[model samples]
Structures are given as C-alpha cells and as structure tokens.
Target: MSGQRKNPQARDRTIGAQLKALRQEQTTLNLEAAARAIGWSTATLSRIENGKRHITSEDVAMVLTTYGVPMAQREELIESARTGVQAGWWSRPLPGVLPDVGTLASYEASARAITDWSFSFIPGLLQTERYAAGLMSEDGAEPLEVTMRWRARLQRQRVLPTIDYTAFLHESALQQPFGGVDALREQLSHLVQASTRGLGVRIVRGRVPHRLLLHPWLLLDFPDAPPVLNVELNGSSVFLHDDEVRSYDNMRSMLDGMALSSAESRSMIGQLRERL
Candidate 1:
C-alpha cells in the first residue's frame, strides 16, 4: 500500500473552470472557434473545458490570448498557471527513495486535513526518529542517508502539531517489531504522547475483520478542494481522484468505526509500551 495522493482531476477542474468563465465573457467565441484559434483539437479543448484533463501553462496562455484578454488580465492568468505548475518542496529527489517523495511531501504540507490508514507499519508522519532511522536502515539506506531521511520524517511529523490529523493503525502495526523491542517500545510511547497532544490515533484490533482490509489507503482532504486517495506502493505511488475518493472515503469510515476510540487508543498504546 502507498501513502501519497495527487488528484490530477481536481487540478484539471480548477483550470477548466477558469477557462469556461473566460469563454463565457464573449458570446461570439464558441467552443470550436476557441479551440481552432488556439490550434488545439476540439476534443482536447472540450475535455479541458469539461475538467476531464489537465491544462498546461502553454494551453492556458494560448486560450487566454485567443480570447482577446487584455495584457493586464493575461498576466494574472499566466501567474496563476505558473503557480499551478510550480514544483512542490517534496518534489526534490531523496538519495535513495523515489524523487516524487518531495511532491507528496509538498501536498501533505499544504493539505488542510489528513486522514491516513496503515496496516503494516506506522505512517511516516507518526514515526519516531529512532523508529524512522531503523526502518530506513532496514531498507538498506546509507548511514548518512538514513539520518537525512529520519530528519525528513521528523519534519513531516511537525505538521501533526500544526494541522488537523487523523491516523488509524492496524493492531498488527502496533504489535510488530519495526527495529527491535526497544525501538517498538519507543514508537508506541511516541504514539501515546502524540495522542495526548491532539493528534487522533486509533488502532484497529486484529480480531475485527472487515472489508476495509481489502485496501489500506490514505485520504487527504484539502481546505478548498476535493479529497485525494493515495494508493501506496513499495516503489511508486498512485493518486486517485473523484470516483476513487468516494470508495476510499467509504472504506475509511468503516475502518474508523472498527478502530478504537481516541481515549481507548491512547490506553492501548500505553499497554503495548508496557509489554515492550
């Protein structure tokens, strides 16, 4: 399973909405005429206007210019496009991990609300520094590189204290020994501490078998946009939007229902720490 979601459709729709509004300003410029003037396929223009596909910077510029937008107005649209295409901080390449980690990290940083569900391990944002180092070490990360990744992970966790976060972990994730007994113990303790500090931490008991087990996913909801479902993978991440968000949202609700309450979850983490 993966943990990153980039909803292309949401981005596309935003651009499309702008295009449609601009086109409506002039009655003479119909869809076909606008498409022709921009030297783009009518179908492609239709999809863009319908919010089905992403509109590139060039496409935005061409359409705005074709619509006879004043120089001042054109500058504003171009500026918007530039912001839209600008690479996020997470898009920077990590030494060993995929380069796209930066892109996902950027999304996480800007997101208003984050809901994550994990089955095998603690989500990166919740990982303790020691646990993060151990996990990266096991993945064969270089010693120095492991430290860098751990720092990155810790930075990601800072968001929890500053933003709204809800995390659901399977019982197996809590019980599993990520690095060693000491590491797992510390990790559990960290979770308990985080819970007390306002992060929502819930654990789904192994005994509660449910359909949500079919796909463990993370759903990220932004302040001014639709939610995104991140399909985690070992090597690459896939982002799902629109219809996929609905499915993940349903599963998230079911999983949340089966998971322990916040207070109980804190107690459970404490109990696990004692055993460790």
Candidate 2:
C-alpha cells in the first residue's frame, strides 16, 4: 500500500512549475542556456521544470543564482524547496483503500473550493460516520480498516467550514435508503445542518436523458493553480487537468443551470426527512 501511495510530490510539482515560470519571465535565456549555466544536463533541468523529479535546496540556489533571481523574490522559492521535502498527513496507510486516496487528500489540502457531483450516492465529505461505516461494510473491509478509513474521511470533513464546498446531488440519491431508513434519515438531517454552516447541498431535479448527464466528477479549484477534475472509474481515479478540464466546465455549467435553488434544496431535504 505504501509503495502505491503518492509521496509529497504535489508540492514539488507546484514549486517546479513556479520555477519554470520564473525562469521564463525573469530571464531571457531558454532551458538550454540555463542548464549550461547551472552545470546540469538539459534533461535534468527539463525533469525539474516538468516536476518529474525533485530538486534540492542547493539546486534551487544554483538556479536562482544562474537566473539572477532578485533577493526579494527568492524567499518563497527557498521555502517551497525546504517544505516540499516534508511528508503530509495524506501519507497515512490504509489496509484496503487505494493509495490514490492519499492523492485526493493532497489535492483537498490545497484546494480553495470543491464542487462534487454525485449521481448514485452521497459525497464522502458530507457523510455521517454511521452512514460511511454502513456504506463501507459491504466492501468486505476489516473492522479496523473501516475505522481507519472513516477516521481519515471525518478528518477531511473538517475542511468544509474553511473552504467553499458545493455539492450537486442527484434527487434520486438523496431519496435512497442507504444504511437503511433510519440511517438515511440521519444522513439527510446531517446534510441540512451542514448547509447551515458552509456546505452547499443542491439537488439536481430534472430527469435528463441518460445520454445527457456525464459521469460523476469532483472538481477541485485552487487559488494559485489550475482546476482539477477527478472521475472515478471502477474504484480507481482519473485526474483531468489543464485544457482537459474545459469539457467538465461545460458539464458543470449545464448542471448549474438546472440545479435547484439552495432554499428550495434545503426545503426539499427537510421534506424528505419529515417523510422519514
């Protein structure tokens, strides 16, 4: 599991991207000239620029010196290099869950906002412990594994109050009796409470044709970086970035136009809870 888990590479990638941008904007020299000046092979510099490999503080110092980076603009890069080597909480191990779970956690840590589209089940961020345990038990995960997974998920939920979270849930999903009727009622009530705090739980009401709705996706937006769209496939994940996220943007816009108003959504959820 540890072998499959993503390391603290996201920060390295972010730093590398910043370095590449700085080198391009601050210096007239291209990669070849910069590599020669820094006494590194062109391929090594390319890997560092593309975030395919990590760079040490000395390497950063060398690049900064070669680029003649102003002292004022050098602190952030030095700090990024120093901190990128540290491991994050996402590195915690889980028995049966995919190592990519760590990858999602890293993204969540940096995201300024998250928009989740759930077609068949409740989004994990908004799930109650009982609800989560109920859902996970069916996977044949061991008791300890279930506890660990739920604990990690609950910890991740702490970010909801600090960040913008808008959940687009299918009406059918909100009505399903997951974890039985009683647990489902609890989950609905929890959603109501969460919305009052910061979570936006909007119900997607229209019965669009099967061909119209795309696969479920989670879009994470960062204040400094590009948005990422994560789509789960057969229990694994696909992370779409850069130009690829535009199509997802289109789908999000279509859904946004059709989703119920927040007030109406809250009322709808209240009514569902009352029926239970």
Error of 2 at 56 (Å): 5.7
Give candidate 1's TM-score.
0.79
lDDT by residue (tens digit), candidate 2, 1-276? 012213334565577788899889999989998888888888978867765555676678778888999986787788777776555666565666666676777778778999988887788889988878877777566788888888778767877877888998888878767678888999999999987775788998868647335577889888776787778665577777678889777777877888997888989999999999
- lDDT assessment of candidate 2: 0.77
RMSD of each: 5.2, 3.9
Query: Once superposed on the true structure, which residue ranges of model 1 sit more than 4 Å away at CA?
Result: 1-17, 20-37, 40-59, 69-73, 83-88, 140-145, 208-211
The alpha-carbon deviation from the true structure for residue 241 of candidate 1, after best TM-score superposition, in angstroms, is 1.1
Every candidate's lDDT: 0.74, 0.77
How big is the positional error of residue 82 in model 1, measured in Å on the Cα after superposition? 2.9
Query: lDDT of model 2 at residue 192?
Result: 92
lDDT of 1 at 197: 88
Which candidate number has the best TM-score? 2
Worst 10 residues of 1 by lDDT: 1-10
